[model samples]
Target: MADPVPALVATGVAHTFGETRALDGVSLTVGARERVALLGRNGSGKTTLLRVASTQLRPDAGRVEVAGADVVGQPDVVRRHLGVVFQSPALDPALTAREALRLQAALVRIDRAEVAGRVADALADAGLADRAGDRVGTFSGGMVRRLDLARGLLHRPTLALLDEPTTGLDVLARDAFWAALDRRRADGAQVVATHAMDEAARCDRVVIVDAGRVVADGTPDALTSALGPDALWLDTDDADALAATLRGEGHDARAVVDRVLVVSPSARDLVAPFYARPDVRALSIQPPTLADVFAAVVGGRGGR
Candidate 1:
């Protein structure tokens, strides 16, 4: 038998905003029930790709399909199969939690008979059944985010496109949102655009984008493994300068955020020079992580 179609597919997708090329020849595929992270720093085209895949923005070049429906040619069809939760809150402050979901169901054209049942299920799934009659404005940031996620699921889409769904949420709130999302979307595929390394680490696959291009794609462990077994970290006053110095000396080193990271097979042996440096404040060694892989791939720029 022939293979089943993927939940999402993008080929040579390119999009430009004026002079800034947001997505440059990007391509990727998400299998059924797979959770893939569109991992990148800000301005890395993660959101652009999501928008294109969701059919909110057409690409300048290339093609995108959601559940075999062409995003451009059959955008309405794609919309039916896609559940999108954007970074911004779409809830109305004056509307009650139940009202918000009811509106969403109407907007999506859910049958009147099913709307009540679906709304009830959504409210319960969001843990907002008790607050169904309460105004959305009265809810916390986490509650509002959860409602938004619930709204996205009214259609039971085949693919979920999440663009930094927990951007301003606290750690606990972020965890709760993911739990709710996991419970609701377990049977569907997910493409989440986020800059959080920890979030990307939890995904089945990570597609790292930089400068509108896909720099790397692999499982988090597999991607980090390419950096070798160990990573040496150097805390210095001038991470960029120290990174440049190390690079000049032929070390595969780069400055990530506030530290200079060196990934090599013999990570311990290369730490002596930094350990003796007056400007170097601390030194440590650990297994390679996604951040280290990002530093190496993006050339030390755009740290999480």
Candidate 2:
């Protein structure tokens, strides 16, 4: 078989705001029908990168392509193939969900006859069919977010860009959004920018951005494995003393809390020895999580 073309591609993309560089040589690619999560802290250029990818902002350097069209040179073509859900809710308060979809269809130049069918399909896909006639103002934050998603999908673009799409949603709403996204990904590509580690874990691939650069990129499992070793959480009366003892024995151990010790890989094999000690109270071993890998790569606690 021949090489597969990317649904979305960015190369050496950079953006600057006066004295500040919003993005520094950022590059990424999402294969056709692939789901990729873009992760970063606030002001880490996640939004800027999304804007460039969506053709809303031009990059100062480098290139962006959506569905094989250059974003800057062929923005109209890119727009035809790209759907974007902005960070802020953009629906008109007075418009009903159905009306909003109709308006969006018109803006995208869909045929009037096809608009209604597309609206119904999109609303049903988003689980908002029952509330289609309700004014957007009456919808809860989660509902409005779903409506925004439905509107983005009205045109059936091949590439969907979501910027913090789950923001403000409770657990149930967030799961619903993820399920909707899962359905979309089954048919096309999705590029999601989020600060939530749990959400990032759902993507097929994750790109961790920090200080305007791609610090790490891989499948969640690969990223976590790269961090090396399972972390053992140990609860003891003397966390500091235990940590010191483990470190003296050339083991990596640190006090993560008052009575909790985060033990390193080498220390895990020797945990049985510690467990045998009379002073050891409780111990739990777990595979490194995405959060742990994120903290290791970014050199700090994972984003809230």
Candidate 3:
């Protein structure tokens, strides 16, 4: 049987703002029930790619498809299946949560009879049902973020295009917000573009971008594991001495200031003896982290 259609797909997407290239031949796919985080630092093309994918900005070159329809060719149909929540404050402060959702439903051309029920469902999904009657200006940042998410649900989109959707939320609130997103996993796909590493860690997979290109893509654990070996960190003023001794003992060591570190494939087996050394003031074993993996893959390159 043929492979099932992906929930979202983009190929050879290229975009530029005047002379500056914002995206360079980017491609990605997210299947149904999968969540992919677009991980990148500021100005790394995350937002630009998201805009193209969401049909907010047409790309200079590329193809984008959401839920089986081409974005450029079928904008109206694509827009119906996609819910976009950008980082900016898109809601009207003067309008109540109910009013904003109602307006959104009207704008999206939802059946007039279903508007109230959809608004109620979205409010409950975002945990904003109680505050639906209150003006959005009175809501907290987290509440506003949630309401923004609720508004996106007005049409029950099949793909959620979120650019830093959790920006202003606290840890607890962010977790709660993700839990809300978790509930939607079974319906379709979620693509989150974010600079926050921890937030990206919450997704099912990560796609790191740098210099207008996609640098890496994998599950957080898979990427971390693929970095190879555990790290042994030694803290002491005698870093040079420690390196010398470790090298003498058949261990590769790199001395940086007061710390000596070694990336050893056999670190787990060899680390037990280092604790008994007199010159080793401190010894710590660090398993490969996603940050370390990300740094290795995308750090130290100049901006685009």
Candidate 4:
């Protein structure tokens, strides 16, 4: 079979603001039906890249295509084929949820007769159908975010770009947002920019960016595996003493907190010996998490 065309593509993309280089030679491609998480620290150019891909901002150098149309040269064509949910709330306070979606459909030149049905579908898809007639200003932050998503889907674009879509949401709200994306991915492609490790793990693939460059890219499991082995966390009154003892016994151990010692993955096989010690208390082994993988990639504790 022929290789599927990319739904979104960026090549040698570079952007600068004053003296700071926001993006430097960054490139990425998302295949049809692919779900990719763009993981990065603050100011890593993830948002800049998303803006370029969505045709909201033009890159200083390089090519960006959304569903095969050049973002710079054919912005309107690209916009018509892409949906964007920005970090900020884009809904107007005065407009009702249904009205907001209606306005989006009209602005996108969706068929007048089809606008109502499309707006209804979009609201339902975002799980905001019950609030369709409520004004946006009265909605909670999560509700407002959902409305933004509903508006973005008004045109049924082939590619969806979500910039920190779950920011500021509580755990329940965040889960709801992910569930909506899960449903959308069942039928199309999505590129999510997120700092939440758990959220990043939900994507089919994750690309880690730091200092305006791609540092790691892979499935969550693959990235975590590179960190060596599962980590063991032990909380004890004498964490330093325990670490010294473990080190003396040839176990790779380091103190993460005054009372907590994080041991190397290899220590799992040797944990029984430590657990048997009367002085050690509260010892547990955890599988490598995306945060651990991110820390290994970015060379420090992962940022929010």
In TM-score terms, which candidate is top? Answer: 1
> Which pairs, if any, clash in model 2?
none
Candidate 1 residue-wise lDDT at 74: 99
TM-score of 3: 0.83
Model 3 stretches with alpha carbons more than 4 Å out: 1-3, 232-264, 268-284
Q: In model 1, which runs have C-alpha deviations exceeding 4 angstroms? A: 236-250, 255-259, 277-281, 302-304
Candidate 1 global CA lDDT score: 0.89
RMSD of 4: 4.3
TM-score of each: 0.91, 0.84, 0.83, 0.82
What are the clashing pairs of model 1? none
Over the stretch 1-304, how does candidate 3's per-residue lDDT look in tens digits? 8876787888999999999999999999998768999998889999998888788899899898998999899988898888888897589999999999999999889999998898988899889989889999999888888888778766867888889888878888888778787777776788999988887888899999998999999999888777556866777768888888888988767675567776577888766678777888778877877666665565546556
Error of 4 at 213 (Å): 0.3
Q: Which one wins on lDDT?
A: 1
> Candidate 4, which segments miss by more than 4 Å at Cα?
232-285, 301-304
Q: lDDT of model 2 at residue 110?
A: 91
What lDDT does model 2 reach?
Answer: 0.83
- In candidate 2, position 175 carries an lDDT of 89
lDDT by residue for model 4 (1-304), tens: 9886789988999988888888888888898889899998788889989988987778999999887899988988888888889899788999999999888988989999998888888899888889889999999887788778777767767898999988999999888777776767655689999888988999889999876677888998888876567766676777678777778877766654444445465757757976887877768777778876665456433332
